[model samples]
Target: MCNQTTTAEKSSPTHIYFDSPEKHCRGTDYLCCSISDIISEAKSLFNLAFPIALTGLILYSRSIVSMLFLGYLGDIELAAGSLAIAFANITGYSVLSGLALGMDPLCSQAFGAQRHKLLSLTLHRYVVFLLFTSIFISFLWINMFNIMVYLQQDHNITRIGQRYLLFSLLDLFTNSFVHPIRIYLRAQGITRPVALASFFGTFLHLPISFVLVSHFNFGVSGVAASASISNFFVLISLVAYIWVSGIHEPTWEKPSFECLTGWKSLLKLAVPSCVLVCLEWWWYEIMIVMCGLLVNPKALVASMGILIQTTSLLYVFPSSLGFAVSTRVGNELGANRPYKARLSVAVAMFISAIMGLSALTFATALRDKWALMFTSDTQILRLTSVALPILGLCELGNCPQTVGCGVLRGSARPSTAANVNLGAFYLVGMPVAVGSVFYIGIGFSGLWLGLLSAQVCCAGLMLYVVESTDWEQQAKRARMLTCIDIRQPDDFDCNKGEVEQPLTCSA
Candidate 1:
């Protein structure tokens, strides 16, 4: 295995390996080698993606379980719980997740470059940052009732939302710890334990929710508290696993003031990551809000809710592929294997494309029955059936675009993806959705049409950018970003005119 000359080695002269000249001279041998390289890349991506996908499904199911418990309480409680969760996701959860992603290239590249101490410091910095952010989010949750009342939301719903959010505040801090730790593990290609932690945490959620809400009569607050407990469970389990398994022996370091020195570089990546994600996430929320203004607003909202839930459920697979590719590409680039990074992107895109097609087919086949899982209302069923096929078509674009964004994040080019999202969703998608729904009188169907258009546009733009990327330059940037000293560099440069060699440091 050590003697094998792979495709990445053959393509890049900087790689310290060589193929036999005679082997290259034979066409069949070269073809066979290329096929083997492709297979290897595919297998590596699959191994990373599968566990991540399962983990995502299990984590998301925790929320689903909460909603299921709320459903049993009655429609009023269910609606309030849903609204509160959506508010939390938009205002706090999604932002935290996106900002945490700023550490993706940093951690993955540091691990790739074998700078284990740097990985530990990066994780420390983010945990502090997210914890600070969580304090502000907790303030928001504490004042949710006042905020809702000021907006003139329904009084009963606002009261329930406030109660649920109050109990959910603990999750904010837990997630601050969980997100960074999970990213640290993933960057080092240690995902199975993280997945296992999530599985057991989620498994505990259902029964805990039932006992709290059904047996103890704690109602919606109990459901929310159960979720917080589950999040804590996941965090504890992950931390214990890391300690007992001895995975942190090499990388774990005492936290210091050095973690606070490099705020600029971290923020540069994090701000755009937050914008890119929030723009997409807030667009869906905006759609739901707009649905509340249409004729028979209740039915439209209910139908849109079902559709959103369905789409969110399906999103796990492709999003997992994106995460896998981000780690793989960042790792390769950090190791200065640009060709391998490029190959990983290709394999990831191919896998996402297949997943997209499968999603499209399955959604179409089950269009009539998909909404039945959430509701029995004839109007909602009708609206959902009509919209499900469009949602499927949207996935064809969404899945690949999601993976492409991950590629950009790994390449340390989140600004490009952020710009594309602004153009696609705000400038293009929102206008089309408004015109189609109101002026064109297409109702809920128009909302989906507009969404489909945005997805296609975003996907096309991301594909072009990824295809035209300069992999060698990205590798250099990863080095400049991750392998340097924690203090911001004054003389170091990453530009087209001058590319520095990889920085070498003691681990």
Candidate 2:
């Protein structure tokens, strides 16, 4: 309660307002700032950037290390692991990750509107729902893992893969709770906890993994158990924080089913977000499958293992930026400050683009060295060397597209993001790129051609959508849903006196 903002007291739901910068500057007279002000602004930005960047690295550290550790586990295991992770990441991330997204816009808007009283119950109930759904999905994934092995062909690799799958299944259930907890903290502008927790998890994970896999000779299962152990610890940490730290709690009035009743709105956003995630994830899985068909599958798989690790690690930056965009933009918009929302979008996109290009440069330079880090397979290394340049180039588009979708999520326009990805990646990008391998005899390089085309086009379309959005119009939509009376410039806003967004429907 001590951290509560003054805006929480306002009674008008439709008229909830963001803190006016004009009023905020009264003491400092922000109309103009001295050189010290510029320094202060930079410092503030740095404060924000460091934690988010560090958080990104910590969160992704596991995947990066896994690629290194597992790549040496042999080609079959390596290939199997890459394909498995891709499949799980795509299907699991889409379903589970998309569900967690409901909190960003909802919770940020609540905080910005000074509706702190609404948070506790929402957070609690949402967690329960997420945990249940994630468990179901985990079981499903485990089954699919078994099916993939039994149906394909019996080999030493498949047997070992089953062990990996079993371990991965356990880890998934534990980590599923992580996203919601992290999102809840970010929504309340309390990010340091999650970041710190991630750092601890990653740090603790490495030693345990090394010990189990090497000292104890647990091998694949050992590595897998370590991951599960780390995730379980992190989940416990989050729960402890929520209970002991007296975090903001949304009310559940008489168990009125507000969350379920209101989930239609959430679903509108979740479905498209899921689609966007699935499209990319599935394609990467296809990439692994493609590697298997090549002359030296072992080298091909290991090189790609390195490549994916590189991309996944870099992806964390844009992901955090996207998270920032959704939180900042949704909060400002919900508080009826369209201008601030626009500014937030601009800030996120610019940073994302810069990070993307930077990642591409590193990927290009380190492509060869990366493959060698895994194994000395000359053939695989050569294939990876050939593919790295193109993959590196794709980052420019991939990063923006990632942030672009995040922007749309903030705008509560996930459907738009989903459509663009489907059209660009599936309809346009994948077919041409994948087909070129056989059709044009370009091999795996041709497959990448399809990928880059889709991602770039998707990114462009996302940017256009962001540009076309009128925040003023968004503010009106926010008001109608919350049932608050806010100022109306034209009194003929897009909602046009309607009670909800036109797209709002049962999921």
Candidate 3:
């Protein structure tokens, strides 16, 4: 039989930390759930936040450095590494990662409910689901390099990109395994496992990068090799953590179909969540291609690359808050307290916005120093300095938007997010952005304008959605908070219930 498991047939695999799902209680005094506990939770959240941000910095910085290091091997390798990363991140990594983010909210709700019964069942089947996705995505990378060449990237670039893709594809394990493993740990209120794991991964990255690039003469392959090595170690670290904690197979006497049913619930939020990410990543891939066609194109691409990357690095903090908020909100909703979910989201968004402002201030203060830390090109620095402040403003919009998406995710309503992103990025944001860049002749500032505009639109929609969220409805929706699908058929016999609905979806 083909290994595709349907909602009915899929069973949740058992793990060590899974508390029985049957014991979940409804109608608790969610307000009385201790302000001290909340503060302590927030404090623990802060501890995880910066570490996650550092991990992002280390991961992205390694890629930046690895590319520069491989450049010493030759321009072909350098160009190839860049091309491969763009292609896979767009089509494979970013595409697959949506499902990973999807896992966090579901796990959070489960953790909040303290329902171990459904724990292993949901995560177990999710692993199976992601394994299928990982396999397909891996094959796509292996098979699609030639198509990328046909897409008209330079020949030398294609060859180098292909070699890097071969190495980069190894993260199917990290993308598929590590994200869920870490998120599930977080759901258990255990931040240390992922914190320690990411640190371990980063620590492992340094020596492997040096040895492969400098010592072994592996060149670009060496950088890719280091990534593969680092990921393997990270995976091993997480698995070991889970194992020692007694959460995996050793304690499992059997599996439950309840968890399998839960996977569908998770998808109700996951699919739309993935679409939101795909839409965002897909557009940037286009922007990168278009930007590469401009005057002083390498500088344009490199300059924007530096700033775009810097935003992603700084993004780790708010992104962590978003994750924390999603978990908190989902847990609250699952426990039948929609109002607290609202308040918690407000608090998290405020905190994230403060963090965003600090990042912006830091970036602005150091804008002239780009020549030192982020890059060395005099022209690129000048270009980036002109652009960094706008990018700093871009952070202002991006901050709440990340948390907003997280809020929507907790409600099992990723479709609202998908449409919001679609409108903000594609309809409202990109047109004016590209036109501004090429037409107004402001160069890349137009692109930044477009991105900033999109971020604002997205933030506005997110705020509106959160404001309008009926916690009671979300509480009910939390019952299905495990699958990746988001579509629902409303009862409307021949279309005249006089109840006009807004766009409905649940990725």
Candidate 4:
């Protein structure tokens, strides 16, 4: 929740409009804030964003560890592991991650509305949903060999990938709990525990991977096992911390048959969220495939790989900011503080813009040296250097657009974002990429340019939607989502009839 203002101040409609600084409400509520308030809001957002970013960085390192060990196994193993990882990310991780996001608005808003039981129920429902989904993903992995072979993949590589995925099955179930639990905690403004647990798990991953791959000679399977064990560690560590710390005491509800039902509200948000995420995630995979078709594909593909790694590394901050703002916005709306929700959006956007600029500068200034981190091959180095600036340009748009997506999610309007992504990436970007690369002979860089185009369009559309948002309407929607029974205060107007089904969530 957020700092509470006096009832009279809460009743003031001026703040809701976000009017000029001169319009100050009585009792410490102001339509516009002084410099100090802006700084305070920025500080609050940063406090939330930094820990999430750190957790993301630590978790991402787990993959780097896997890749390093796979390389040690040999070229074929590395190639197979990379392919399997990509496939897992596309077909498995992306879906689960996106589906888990459906809980963000519900949990954050429910917590804000002081509907503690709702939070617990929503969490349980999502955990079950993801677990069920994982069963299907497992089947997909089981048939990965057939799928890869059908796609004309090398027999040896396909076989290795198949084995890797088979051993990786445990990850899906563990992550079923892991993903939602992290979000459940995050929505309550609890991040340090998740960060610490990830650190602990990732820390153990190194030795566990060593023992399994080197000491026991489990080979590729060991690498897969290490990943699953690490994830399990993360999941268990999170649950243990919650229990010992008693953080879950307030919101933890007993399991009930109710969790099995109520799929309607969750699925409404989840399916679009899944599509929105998969569209963007799969775009990178498609680009990687496209890279293979370019002239001198080996070098192009190699350069693309390094660039993708670079972008993923840089993506942590923006994505973290996005989540932070989502929580902030949702919490405020749920608490009936439209002013604070809008403030969250503004402050987050400013921060993301600055971050994007910094990233652009870093990528541009260090383009030559950045590639050196991954390769000594002269051709790849030159190719990566050329692409780095474009990648930087992509981030310039990527950061804001990503935050925009979060704002939409917080507002319970993920369908809008999904549509924006579909139109921007597929409608506009894909054609541009194909035209530039094949028709215009722009080569590998064209693919990035295509991505940049998507980012630009996405950012523009997202900003438009965000700026045009009616925060009060969103707050009303939040109340409905949490099934809050509102007793309109004497001085406050609850915007009656703005949202239907105000208590339908309970029904």
RMSD of 4: 4.2
TM-score of each: 0.89, 0.83, 0.81, 0.89
- Weakest 10 consecutive residues, lDDT, candidate 2? 1-10
Q: Whole-model lDDT, candidate 4?
A: 0.83
lDDT of 2 by residue, 1-507 (tens): 001122333322221123353443343211223346435433433455467767878767776666666765667767666656655676565677777776666666666666554454456556666777777777757675565555443345456655776777766666567876677677666777777677777878888888888789887777677877877777777677666776544421333455454455556655676676777767776676676566655566556666777677777777767777777776776687765666566556667778888988988888778778766778778877888888878888888788777767766777777788888888988788767976788886787788888878888887777766766667666555444444645564533455565332111
Best by lDDT: 4
Candidate 3 lDDT tens digits, 47-82: 646556666666666566665665456544544565
After superposition, which runs of candidate 3 have C-alpha atoms over 4 Å from their true positions? 1-51, 54-61, 64-68, 71-79, 143-145, 247-266, 480-507
**Model 4 TM-score (2 dp):** 0.89
What is the Cα-based lDDT of residue 6 in candidate 1?
39
Q: lDDT, candidate 1, residue 397?
A: 94
Best-fitting candidate, scored by TM-score = 4
- Model 2 has an lDDT value of 0.66
Give one digit per residue, the lDDT tens place, for model 4 in 1-507: 233344532344443324565555344544455677678888888899999999999988987788778767865676567667767888998999999988888888888888888888888899999999999999999999888677665677669888899999999999999999998988999999999999999999999999999999999999999999998999899899989999989789887899998787679888988887888888886786676555665566556666777888889999999999999998989899977888788878888899899889989999999766555669878988999999899998899999999998887788899999999999999999999999999988899899999999988898878877777668878887776646645553333434464322643
Q: What is the C-alpha lDDT of each candidate?
A: 0.81, 0.66, 0.67, 0.83
